[model samples]
Target chain A: MAATYVSYFGFVIKSVRGMFTGGPRYYAWLSFLVLLMAAGAAAYYRQAVLGLGVTGMTDQVSWGLYIANFTFLVGVAAAAVMMVIPGYLYHDKAVKGGVLLGEMVAIGAILMCLLFVMADLGRPDRMWHMIPPFGKFNFPVSMLAWDVLVLNGYLLLNLHVPGYLLYKRYRGEEPAKWLYLPFVYISIVWAISIHTVTAFLYTGLAGRPFWNAAILAPRFIASAFCAGPAFIVLVLEIVRGWTRFPMGDRLITFLRQVVLIAGLINIFLLISEIFTEFYAASAHVASARYLFFGLHGHDALVPWIWTSISLNVLALLALVSRRFEQRGLVVRNLPLAMLIVAIWIEKGMGLVFPGFIPTPLGEIVEYLPSANEVVVSAGIWGLGLFVMTVLIKHAVDIETGAVAKNN
Target chain B: MSGGSRIRPGDVKRRGFLKLLTALTAGAVTAPADAEAFDLDAFLQKHFHQMSDDEKRRTLQRLEQDYNDKYERDDFTVVADGPTPGVKFAYALNLSKCIGCRRCVHACVQENNQHRGREERGDQVEYIRVLEMEKGSLDLEKAVHDYDHEVPAEDKYYMPVQCHHCNAAPCVKACPVEATWQEPDGIVVVDYNWCIGCRYCAAACPYWARKFNWIEPRLPADEINPDTHYLGNRPRYKGVMEKCTFCINRVRKGLNPACHDICPTGSRKFGNLLDKDSVIRRIIDHKRIYILKEEVGTDPSFYYFFD
Candidate 1:
């Protein structure tokens, strides 16, 4: 037993050391990420010292960019299930080869989600109060508490699955079914729960009519499947181009089909939400009005929502058109990139920002993230990308037998 | 003057540099000087309700010392008194008598030690927001809270909203750490030290009563209210949620709230809801009363009445 633990420890140390040794282009990319992360740390330090007042947030619109980004990234983290379902349930060999990479993306995305939540907090130092036993954990009651549990749970599942699989691969042994199979299945369900709980964070609030719709959870799931697979398809392409990871074109085609169907359903759910909000025209429609058009001539989000809608339509059309099948790599990937960006805006700025407009007291105060906020957000994204680059590179090296135990 | 020649590059650069310098200077001057040191006492302090009697006393002493040092007043004290038994506090406002003079708004700020800096400084927190509404319409969408006109416009009525201290308070339920809860007296209070400042409670409140300390609260030493309840007006830190405690300190001592006392028209009323002879009970029993956003089902202790 002790021998096994030592071997595992050795494997981790060697794999991590190997991650530091890469090509010139990889070094340049890492350096750039480091620069971004440094900028982010500096900005966050200033914010901590000066307070959230440095951001554009006010008592009128209490939440702003950080929460918006946190909400959107939760979907991205949940999207890893798209890879899990096909790879494990259907036994697709091409996808099974890349599931570990997909889980690595989940790890990176979840890290970003937690960081965004931390960035949004006013008393992050007092976060220990949420811990169980030692501090109060208002579980089953506060949706935020449920979110903390599910997010951390999802992160653990992803970490264990990928870690166990890679260690077995490094040792050139087949992983026992019981060791990882049950977790794979549980992770699929857990993935859905993470995003559903995140949606509940917004939907459970009776105060914000804009987010009170039953359709929100379904919309979150639909968008997650679409954006999640679309993102993986893009990452798989990069892995295929940059390294000898042996990714087949067939996996890309399969993920594209998933994205196409999920994207259609996402658009359908969005239409349902729009119809429900606009058709009835209740007093609750104030927020929706502010989002889709202008409310009392305070139309900060009108352009944003329209642009998101137009992009969603265009991306869905591109996915459906024969041109997607006939085109080369760049042409095919454009729609996927477009879909990712559209969902980011639709879920982040288009969803979270409008909920605060026409505040509960019927006040309309527009919120735009300050430059400091934008810098901080960028730094987090840079950190996530840096983490993913190192993780995926190490996993690819192990899988390709380039960093085997014998070496 | 030609558009191209309106400004020289040298002049523009110098102006920009001066502006940046002024902003930096202002930020430096306003930034809390004591913020650099790690506050071990605050870090290790237990939740208000969870602390033992001795711990509570020690915590209160530490807080009093901090406040005294910051405000330069040795008389400042932090009281952690429990709720008065058998007293369920409630409030009522006579809508017909309200003149919208905004005296209650300023009075609450003074009594509560709320942030009093300009908006640009990020410390302008006022618990009571007076909405100027069209008398004929019940629609809040048409209500204006930022009116600059004279008192009591011909067709307008003023509605001042604060923490309703709901029977089933959504903000209390929304707190992930149980940092805020309804006291025995039906007043909802937040442990400023325990809050993580996620602002979920702020979003959950239909009345928009809870406020976040976006910046460190800047209370001028002279304006600081020394008589403070621990859960009520004791100074709050940046990144925590605070709300109207229904004047927990004053009401428990048989004194009316600052807002109620300062109302010139006798429009605001406060008393024990559990007492049958209380003015709040009398108003609810006899007057045409309305609960704001009753559809939300918060069951607020506060009511609006037509006298």
Candidate 2:
């Protein structure tokens, strides 16, 4: 067992060196990526030094693109559970090694979600008030408190469950097979709960009529399943092209099916939302009107929402078509890329913009992303992606028994 | 004879005094073993059927006193036989006989102990949202109030909106926290401390009767209302919401809100909607009185009838 661990670790070290010197000039490319990250860091500093006033957010549109990204990323994190639970708990051999990557991605996405919330809060210093005893933490009553708890819990689960399995495997020690089954079941329920609660956080608000709907929780889940699987597929393609990652075709086929099912549900939910809004045409429907059809002088959100709907339909079609799903790498990437973007738009803008469309005065106002807002949002994305890249690299190494020999 | 002599009046009297002292001390320390006991769980468990006659009498007396303390006032007690089944309130608005001076706004700020803005910023904290509506557009929809422009721009009518003390308030129902509630005589009040700052009440209110303090409220000591109600304009804590309470302190004290007393245009009106002979009732019956967002079905006590 010790010899196996040592040999695996040695292989990882050689692989890292080979990529830089012996293999295709990947080291040079990595250096360029580092430079890009440095640029993102500079932008992040500007945000920290200046107050939230520097952001594109105004009193009229208190939350803007950053929150949209945060919302979208949360859905992505929830999507990882789709892979983890089915693969481990259900004993799916095709999805075994693949599930760890999803969990790693979740860890990255959750960290970004937390960071986005910190950036959103004007007084980030007072976040400690969320702690107990000294702080006034209202349990079960404040949804914000619940969000903090669940997001953190989900992230820890992703880290520990996968991390433990990978650790045991690297040691060439037989990991207890039944150990993860219970966790996998918990992850399945927890995964659905995370996204559902996030939806409830918004829809539960009786004040924001735009968000107050019974369909929202299910809509969020549908979006998560659609977007989450789509993202994983895209990442798999990228990994396959770049490195000698052992990704199975069976796993890809399985994910594509899940994406198609989720996509149909997402589209259905969108239609139902429109029906409820147009049919009722009540005072509560004003915000939805502003989002879809321009409210009194507030036509800004109409184009964005329409584009989102279009993208969603297009993505759904791509997934439903078996020809497109099982196409050549380049051809398949197109639909997968489109699906990811479509979900991002649907989750980010479609989810948040409608809530603010018709102002309390029944006036429609537009939210334009200021440069600062874009940069800050970009920085957060870069950070999450960067973290994801490192974590996935470590995971991939661990999985193929390459990182064992180095330690 | 010796035993009788030993049991003297002095010893007997001393024993009686000690007994009386012990009884008085116990009574003072524990209060009465009635409904007002420290053990609320025990008191709650004791069913009405189980309650002693003395307990029932004490409870009734306490309830009666609480009722008197909450509602009854010497100046404005409810008169069941009157035109309205409550105190008669009269509102006199003479828009034709006035100018758009914002003295009323200032009066409201000072009288209500509003948070003072920074000296450098010259901030305005007026709850009364004044709308300078254009003429010939009788519809409130075309009402364009350029707040950035000076007050009373040429050819504009000033309209102010506050908590309408609505008879059927939508805000009261929308409040998940039960922070804002309707008073017995039809006044809407917000308990600032009790509010969770979720802003649901603000969204539900047709008249926009609520305001959320996004940041901590800053007011000088002198600016604070010493006689502040927990529900009304007390110095609000951060993260809680607040709003106009119809000057609840003065309203309960048989006085009008400062804004009403200081309005130059007499455009602002107030009164008991129930009173038949009252000016508010007269305006509602005789003239076209409009409530903001009437489609929302929030029956506002604050009515606007063009002169």
A104-184 in candidate 2: lDDT tens per residue?
788889998988877665444445444654344445664555777788888877877876677676666777867765676
Candidate 1 per-residue C-alpha lDDT over A1-407 given as tens digits, one digit per residue, 9 for 90 to 100: 99999998889888998788799999999999998887777667767876787677777677888888888888888888888988988998988889888999999999999999999898888889988676898988999999999999999999999999999999999999899989999999999999999999889888889988889999999998898888888889899988999888788888899899999999998888889888988889998888888987778888888888898899889888847765777888999988888898888678888888778888877887766677789899999989988999999999888888888
Candidate 2: how many backbone clashes?
Answer: 10
TM-score of each: 0.95, 0.67
Q: Please report how far candidate 2 places residue A50 from its true position, in Å.
A: 4.5
Counted clashes in each candidate structure: 0, 10
Judged by DockQ cut-offs, the docking class of candidate 2 is: incorrect
In the range B1-307, model 2's lDDT, one tens digit per residue, is 1111010111012224345335333442221111121333322322233347766555444433432343342221211111224753434354443345657757777766664554333333456555556655544444443244566667876666556666666566554434566666665666543454444455455554565443334455445444544346545543345667777666666667788878765666677656676667777788765556666566566656666
Q: In order, what DockQ does each candidate have?
A: 0.43, 0.03
Candidate 2: what lDDT? 0.62
**Which tens-of-lDDT digit does each residue in B60-136 have in candidate 1?**
99889988887789988789778788999999999999989889988999999987755433236778888889988
Stretches > 4 Å off in candidate 2? A1-50, A177-179, A405-407, B1-126, B130-261, B265-307
The alpha-carbon lDDT assigned to residue A401 of candidate 2 equals 65
